[model samples]
Target: MSHKGCCYDNAVSESFFSSLKRELLIDTSQHSAQQAKTAIFEYIEIFYNKQRRHSTINYCIPELFDSSFS
Candidate 1:
């Protein structure tokens, strides 16, 4: 957890939402709740986790980074 009212504490989450807006929601504003949920799930699981290279982890796919610990 982080101190209350500290934006830095939430920087990672904020960055993610910013990316989601730019990459996924820029043109669309409306969707059924179920559709929105499914889209987010696919974005995070299929694209973000599996394919997006994260700079914070030395430009590695998250799954690759995670497997190094096992």
Candidate 2:
């Protein structure tokens, strides 16, 4: 858990949610809760984890980073 008022402790999570809002949520409207849930799932599993390049990982996709350990 992050310490109270320590922004650095939550920087990674903050960055992720910021990207999610910017990339997927802004200007898009979902018809239902389930629809929003599905969209978020796809964004995380298919795009964010499998396709998007993260600078912290030297611009490698998260799937590639995981595979390197196998």
Candidate 3:
């Protein structure tokens, strides 16, 4: 296993958390860890992954992207 304190070992994870905190966490002020978990889960599952539009996905939201692929 890699050393515990290596900063380079976590670059991707840090980037992901930075993006998440910048994009999602800043929009919310959750009081509890459980609430934050649930809110993040819903935002990713119900909104971002399922309904949010991505330019990389050809301007269609995820839900429509799947249908168009069929």
Relative to the unseen true structure, what is the C-alpha lDDT of residue 64 in candidate 1, on a scale of 0 to 100? Answer: 88
- Scored against the true structure, residue 28 in model 3 reaches a CA lDDT of 93
The candidate scoring highest on lDDT is 2
Which ranking of candidates, highest TM-score first?
Answer: 2, 1, 3
For each candidate, what TM-score against the reference? Answer: 0.69, 0.77, 0.66
Q: What's the true lDDT of residue 3 in model 1?
A: 82
Q: What are the clashing pairs of model 2?
A: none
Write one digit per residue (lDDT tens) for candidate 1, span 1-70: 8789787988999899888888877766656988888888888889988889999999998888999999
Q: Sort by lDDT, best first: what order?
A: 2, 1, 3
| Clash-forming residue pairs, model 1 | none
List RMSD in Å for every model shown.
3.0, 2.6, 3.6
TM-score of 2: 0.77
Error of 3 at 16 (Å): 5.7
Each model's C-alpha lDDT?
Answer: 0.86, 0.92, 0.80
